[model samples]
Target: MPELALKKETGLKKETRSEELLQLVVFQLGEEEFGLDIMQVQEIIRIPEITRIPHSPDYVKGVINLRGKIITVINLDTRFGMEQKVHDDNSRIIVAEVDENVVGMVVDSVSEVLRLPLSTVEPVPEIISTKINANYLKGVGKLEDRMLILLDITKVIMEDAPSKVAYC
Candidate 1:
């Protein structure tokens, strides 16, 4: 049951579209895996140098020059009230489109793109002990050995935005 051996056993490749599910891009923050709609993801890039903007919230990591366009980067862990982590070489920025605007999210690592069928996706249940609000989550999805929290990206961002940002 060593970590490496367990990974090897679970790493067997499968056909991309197995007629049951659509692919999702998976990434990690702390110990949990979360997913966003694959079609919403523009690209994954290395941690870029961000220009800090004064008067912004701690979760707003600042802007990055992506091919000459400035995009805001948000730290998911911080937004969720988790302790901030120091960035390392393995850290990544996942660019996703919401409300026609491209935003980058920082994650500890990108795991894989998985194809999950509609049947495997379930409504987010009303769990009394859940720490985060349900508006930020679309649903819970079950895949082979994992359960992913599918994010409603637009809602997540909108819920935290200032009145000015929300209308823009």
Candidate 2:
């Protein structure tokens, strides 16, 4: 019957929509775990020699030459107003595209790539207590035993652009 066929189609659509997944490249900054959309990330590399720019913001770690391309690096800990930690062997640079610019972020370590269903992601909480500004968060991803702070990379990179002309 037409009604039965229509019901089956609608059920299939709902099932597919509910199963949609968001892939993220998770990384650690200080004591918190953060997730960035995998599509935005270019690559992950070990820390290299960075050329410090004079008089730059404290969050700017410097710049690095990546295969003949100059990429600016940001220290997430300092940017989030967290205590700075020494980089060790686990330290890594996450190269990502933000607002048409290729930039790198220094994180304590790179964690596993996560694939979370859309149903698990919740909007930013009103009382969420995080050192990082709420404007930089996309949402909070809830897992069985843990949670991930999803980051809006564009906001993270351009938060001060209006006031900081040097960063533009």
In lDDT terms, which candidate is top? 2
What TM-score would you give candidate 1 relative to the actual structure? 0.81
Per residue, candidate 1 scores C-alpha lDDT tens digits across 1-168 of: 699887775564343344466578998888888988899999999997888777777778888889998888888888777777787887899998878878889999998998778788898888635655788888888878889988888886667674323222
lDDT by residue for model 2 over 1-168, one digit each (tens)?
Answer: 999999999999999877989999999987788999999999999999999888778888988999999888999999899999999999999999887788899999998998999899999999967778999999999999999999998898887872331242
- Clash pairs, model 2 backbone: none
Candidate 1: 10-residue stretch with minimal lDDT:
159-168
Candidate 2: how large is its RMSD? 3.4
Q: In model 1, which runs have C-alpha deviations exceeding 4 angstroms?
A: 1-20, 162-168
Clash statistics: count for each candidate: 4, 0
C-alpha local distance difference test of each model? 0.80, 0.89
What number of backbone clashes does candidate 2 have, counting pairs of residues 3 or more apart or in separate chains? Answer: 0
